[model samples]
Target: MTDQTKIRSGGRAARRAARAAPLPDHMRPVRAGLTGGAYRPLTADGMDRIHAAVLDALEQIGLADAPPSGVAYLTGAGASLGTDGRLRFPRTLIEDTIARANRSITLMGRDPAHDMELSGARVHYGTAGAAVHLVEVDGRTYRECGVQDLHDAARIADTLDNIHFLQRPMVCRDISDNLEMDLNTIYACCSGTTKHVGVSFTDPSYVAQAAEMLHMIAGGEDKWRARPFISNSNCFVVPPMKFATESCLVMEECIRHGIPVLLLSAGMAGATAPSTVAGAIVQALAECLAGLVYVNAVQPGHPAIFGTWPFGLDLRSGAMTGGSGEQALLTAGCAQMHKYYDLPGGAAAGIADSKLPDMQAGWEQMCSNVTAGLSGLNMVYEAAGMHASLLGFCHESLILGDDLIGQALRCVRGIEVTEETLALDQMRAVCMGGPGHYLGTEQTLGRMETDHVYPRLGDRTSPKEWSELGKPDLLAKATARKAEILSRRSAAAFDPALDKALRERFVIHLPR
Candidate 1:
């Protein structure tokens, strides 16, 4: 076997052994199917309102005043690498071409998606950074993760998927140490992925410190100044939320440094912005556009990722419930808006407000993720278990989310039609011969790989066979699969000196 394949196999085996013990019933993932479709498109008037908002943003806000490189990245947002040797931007087509191109670029082992890459995909397992507060395993709960946990998590994630970036755990249950908590979490949790890291810091010095660490990790000043692993300058603008001055300053620094910024807006229908879905979308668009304008005005050519994550408030309880129709609408709307600017867009998926994995969580996560995928979003965040979302994380939920994302990716492949799919010759052969010999034909063999949906966890065997194999349910199968993946833990190659340097530079404090 190839060295890479061997490493992967061994790593999976190792992870599986670590999680060999059966999961408790409360921790097992809940099984639930898709809910009935209930989507409503915006009306003509609503569309007009949205159009006006976009126009206002373009004219009034304009681009931020940034360096040449920043301008090249920003104004060139949707520009594609053309065969003619020139950059091409489609004014008429507002799609996630930039993000798609970025994804393609990153997959080729480069930093193309910029900051979005860090926010988009990658795996980091274990308790570390901010995650220390959120992860409860082996009779441990709410314990702050130190530096050791962060490296361990990074190592675990590294052993799994090619973790491209890192996110600080939901450390600091209260808001007091939000910045320190987030930075420490990010520093500990991510390594050997991409150099990029993210945090929603509202303190200028803290943002600078984070930026400095990012610079250090990227090798030196030259690499740091070049990109410095795109850090986000995130802020909330709508009611129930207020914009922070530090975030604004960080956005300026990001623009000056050519770092990509994401203008995030989170609002709840009926409570924060509007009562209807369309109104909420419009408000979200307005908020994001305003941030875009500010960023562009400061540094016109700065790279940016447009984002919207608005949900509905349970009017009776005034709680922000993530698994709601509003969440799906917001996700879809963000993709649509990205098309308008020909820019990459961001939306949250795989989140449930439920404290545990349940029918509510499953349906909510599935609908939102499917909507984002169908809308052709450039990047979808929170693609794993985010319970009481913006509140906690569940390991089983993350596994289930991985499954859901796989399905969504399959959906995005759309329907393919080819000569083999037509199968005219095969049909004729079957008709002439009789009953059902076509299953053994070459055409069937050729088409099976493409036409069939082979689920990784779902039951497809006959009842007798299934019973004989231990009568495992979908959840049980998923659990087993997750264990299998964890068992094969092999390390990825990295510069030992650099890894050691980063660890030495950043120190984590653990309370005794």
Candidate 2:
């Protein structure tokens, strides 16, 4: 069949599959938990006010001027190019991109059936588009994580259907000489996923290196340059709370390179911002819009993602309380504003204030992830292993996050209506005979799969059967499932030459 015919057939089959899939146990529309009693839909007036504010922000403040290359790397906050001799992200690229773009995109892979597309999910996580940190191996910790860890992480993400992008592994030991290390790190990590790679265009030279590395991986410069890859430069505009000149320069570089930008505005409500959730959201939106306008001025259609991670402050210790209800509300409100602009929105989900894997962590993470999902965020970041106000990453948290994301996706599947579901013919046949019996009908056997999901984790056994297996909590079952996945996990193999080439790119020596 021709490609067009194949697409049509595939679309039909997908619809049928969607209808056939059993509805999730929790099928009601998820409500965003605001500080008030419950979430109230945005009124027409509220939407208009937000729109006017965004437009005004775009026209008034306007983006800072920077070189085309610098504009290409624009990020959020007050980030600008050329700061202390280090490159920075431009705020303008981010502002402009948010003003335009389709905002919606399906994160599909080899199998469309496995795709999970959101209206827009918030994307943040990287301050400079990628994190630089040390890694723990066995009992000892390593100072630097070259490209090897990056590739490993990429391979793992590639195997999972839920994770969409490859983020640079936390590798912060030496930044001065090993600039290429970060670039290669992002490339290796992103090579495994079909989705985009988030990177920091803080260093223009490194940005060029990353672009070259991507070209090499895609089988030459032409294909690599043509492929769709997502990269955002971040600026911290709002200091204990915004972006500076550094952010503007990075954004400029991103604009020059035609890379997507994210205006990440993160401030602690009640500290950096007002205590009220609505007030915090407004401030965060203002910060993001400032960046958005800059990007639009440089290039109207530059791809951008709206990112708001405004949290509340722990008044006692003056720390950012990422688990506050205000954070969830900010996510939802930002999503509304982004939808108005038809721009992709991003926010934090699965983040916790807890120091470890405990009840607090579970609840906080669940609430945040659910809020983002319900708010129609296109790119929700921090999907796996964030802790202590997003200062640490844990393997167990990553495993738990996979389950959480699975549940969220199931929630978004919505409901379906079909002949098989209603069982009209079976009802008629049985009713005609005075409700005697339809259990033995062929129709029942043929449609059983269409009516049930048969969850792999939830309990459905009878009391007697449950007694035989020993009663266990859902957490225990989830733990067991994680063990099973780890046991069956196999590392992805790559072309030996390609792997060698990728590794060679990270040739900086570390202090022993």
Candidate 3:
């Protein structure tokens, strides 16, 4: 072989070694809680207007149909009940609640290492939503989601590097009983991953039984309260400025049991909410602020995520447009409001309007995920494995989404311009005295792992190389990876004795 051939082979080996090297958590290219308020879809004036509208909506219009207990919670906290039974928040009350709310809170994971510090523009991406069907790997077939599917999705999410948490993403359609389904959802998510899990209850009465299970898993109620890993994804509001009575009761119970709550206000644009983007954000913010008042009234500074999940709609069809650019703007705009209030907030993103994980799905998922992360959304939900506008969940799509989110996070990290990062000396070294390119420079080699994100399933090969190796399909690669991840016994699974006891106490539908 020629000397040039030897040099080329050696360079390739060095690059491989650099890519394989381990990075300290701080040095990694992307991670949870990277500051992101850089992309502001809403201007300062626009935000001021939205905030004013929110206050007006809460005070003048008010929210109707609050549960009896919710009425007490709000009224006790300076809110007044109208003769019409609608709850109106005093402007002073709203301002005071925001002043006393938890500005920064730690969302603990079952394993302490996975804890997320949600404050400011700190970003975390994870799975969420309640899809009823499982999209088969074939991309065309669908099946009703079972308890095992939920467990498998959690396990897959656990192994994914970019997915930060696992919320109950699908319903167990096989379970006929709502209470049983709720219990199994909790057991499946908790047992499948040590990461923070989010679940919802069908009724307020279910909270006591669920708390018992959580306490048992946590070794006691005290332990659970100290570092509560599970949070309640409570949809306390039914949207368009109204309370979901039963869900409000569940939120109350969860707060009483020391569980963190996601005060979700999912208003759809042009439908449940106003047609305009600004109007949608105003309504969502108003609803969540009311929830904040309720939570703080129950106990001062209870952990509640400002979940302003206003979605988009295809105006002509009246169907949900979860993947539209308008949807991205809505999520990003809501994130801006969260930052304006300096509150820990979450919103929906990474949803695919496409029915399958094809080209359409890729662009749609990346578009929203990028905007949401860049806008500094505190908790980015539905960031993976959602398709058909969140009606279907696919494991292969989730594996692929890990790769997609890795790239999105790199964008969120943005360009650093410190003295060392400016690289003037290195530029001088290469341009004046060296090889005239940055291929094998000392700085380039040093930053290979730290500055760049490498895809696990995405192929980046030359056409000739691809032809020689037999071109690989992205979906096919994801399928193989999904199989590999699910085949292994989850490290996060509960201890055998504990699992047996849990199975005996609660009718866990997931097979042992």
- For each candidate, the alpha-carbon lDDT, in order, equals 0.52, 0.55, 0.93
Stretch of 10 with least lDDT, candidate 3: 14-23
Error of 1 at 107 (Å): 10
Encode model 3's per-residue lDDT on 335-383: one tens digit a residue: 9999999999999999998888999999999999999999999999999
* TM-score (C-alpha, index-matched) for candidate 1: 0.70
Indicate whether candidate 2 or candidate 3 has the larger lDDT: 3
User: What value of lDDT does candidate 3 attain over all alpha carbons?
Assistant: 0.93
Taking all chains together, each candidate's TM-score versus the true structure is: 0.70, 0.70, 0.96
Query: What is the per-residue lDDT of model 1 for residues 1-512, given as tens digits with 9 covering 90 to 100?
Result: 99999998887676556445544423322111111112224544656678675445433443333334333544455433334322223432223332232221111111443232212222111111123244443342435434444444343333322122444434444334656655654454444234244445655456666766666655666776665454463763533323344566666666565556767777778887777776677667656655554565466546566667677777888887677767777767666655544554566665677766667778887787777666666556665556665566555555565556556655554555788667787788789876667764556644444344445555679999999999986555655655664455323323567656655665534221
Give stretches of model 1 more than 4 Å off.
1-40, 43-45, 53-169, 172-180, 192-197, 224-230, 236-242, 434-438, 450-453, 473-494, 509-512
lDDT of 1: 0.52
- In angstroms, the error of model 2 at 144 is 10
Task: Pick the winner on lDDT between candidates 1 and 3.
Answer: 3
Find the candidate with the highest lDDT and give its number: 3
Model 2, 74-182: lDDT tens digits are 4333444443333233334444445355455443322233233435333222111233322232332323434444454555555554455544435533445556555
Sort order, lDDT high to low: 3, 2, 1
